[model samples]
Target: MQSDSDRTGLAIGLSLVALLLFDAMGLIIKHLSEHYSPAELSAYRNFFGLVPSAIALWSSRAWHAKGRQLWMRQWKVGCLRGMITTLAQFCFYMSLGLLPFATAATIGYADALFMTALAVPLLGEKVGKARWLAVGIGFAGVVMIMGPGSQSFTPAALLPLVAAFCYALSGVLARRMDADVPSPLINLYGTATSVVGASLLTLALGGFSGIRGPGDLGWIVAMGMFGGSAVLLLVISFRMTQQANLAPFHYFGILFAFVLGWIFYDEAPVDDLMPGAVLVAAGGLLIVWRERQLRRARLWGARGPHTRI
Candidate 1:
């Protein structure tokens, strides 16, 4: 049998790969945003992304063992999540087009802070002083990157911040889903809804623009595949180990984004990201540390103080 440590190692590897794929998708979106509307790009992405979700659902052994159940109890919640995700994608894609790649990507990290704050009201979770302080620190970093009063700051910077909030809200709401419903199934519902929502958004935004060229078409397809495959890998990683084991590694994504932005776009925003990015990372790590402590405490309490380690 595979040891717990080995499984965790494998899960971390998969998580890192997933983050890289997600960053690749972001790169493609940034590249294509020059010619396509965010609404159209989102619609195309969801349409192609549905294939991987379907494949993941079909291959789910647990879902298959339960007779391939297709319906979920929280279908409305799934749809709402999809709608919110569409908004998130639209905003983030717009930011990618308007701002520097690294800057937009770094600002989007605020989603972690938003997720932590939202958990209090959304999940009825109690917030301790440490986590609250971490949130404040993370927000301060976000404000520094945003540079609200600085001459360089533009309202466009707010797009990724809004995107981060919507993304965090969608994630927090996912916790309310029926546990018995397979994750892949829930993902499919959201992806399907996103397809419809994105389509409507495209129509509202004056319909899809003609594909700029064959090369752009190819990039769009690649973008969808990268996103879909990342989601699939994440599902596999989640199944293999505890989420907390993988959560901290998500910070690696900022590093990946920074490197990619520097290499591909010649964007070195050291001045913009500097100490702010450090605080953002530190704050998130602090939250992760506190969550681990609480989890360990709960486990110890459940052992009745008499169980062996």
Candidate 2:
């Protein structure tokens, strides 16, 4: 049997794999988007992705979650969170088309910062002063990465920023309701919501006539495969590992983005990006570290005063 520590290590390692899977997903989606609108890509990805998701749910008998119907629960929150996630995914895809893989990944890291801010409002969760300070440090690093008012800042970069905000909002919602809903059910509903939402928007925006040719469809299929697997992998990791144990590995996505850019997209990583990347990463790292410390502090605080020897 795997020891608890061993499993935690494995889980953290798997989460890093999940992050790279996210990076690989960007390249695939970008290629597909060369021929498709973000909506069309989302529509197709969710539609095709459902086939495998359905199979996994059925095989694992995850459909019968707690013997309770979804309607009996907070269905609105789930769908709303799914919509926010859909929008976030859409904007991230948009940025991938307009920016280099690493650049877009770096820009999207702002989502973590945005998430921290939004948690206070949406989840009514109070982030201690330390995490708040860490958020500032992290965003400062992102600003260095972005270099606003310079040639590096462009209209396109804002797309990822907006995506980050939406993701932060959705993440808060997901965390609040995670225990009440089964992971598979959440995936099922979220996938369906994305497809329906994307379809309606596609029609409103003039339909999927320009989505892609056959070659691009292949890329979309591959993207959907990686997307589903990444979700499943990350979900498993969360189940097995403490987030602090998994947090450092999350930065592997940035490294993966850099590698993919050079290998496939011919993007040459630059020097300015490194310092900012390190700053932003360190800030985010501190945020997680402080949050973990606060949890321990609060736990001890609740345990009553210590008696003097």
Clashes of each: 0, 0
Q: Which residue runs does candidate 2 get wrong by more than 4 Å?
A: 55-65, 68-72, 210-214, 302-309
Across 168-263, the per-residue lDDT of candidate 1 in tens digits comes to: 999998888988888999899988988899889999989988888889889988888889989999999999999999989988998999999999
Q: How accurate is candidate 1 locally (lDDT)?
A: 0.92
lDDT of 2: 0.77
lDDT of each: 0.92, 0.77
Compose the digit string of candidate 2's lDDT tens values, residues 163-195. 888878877777777575666666667777888
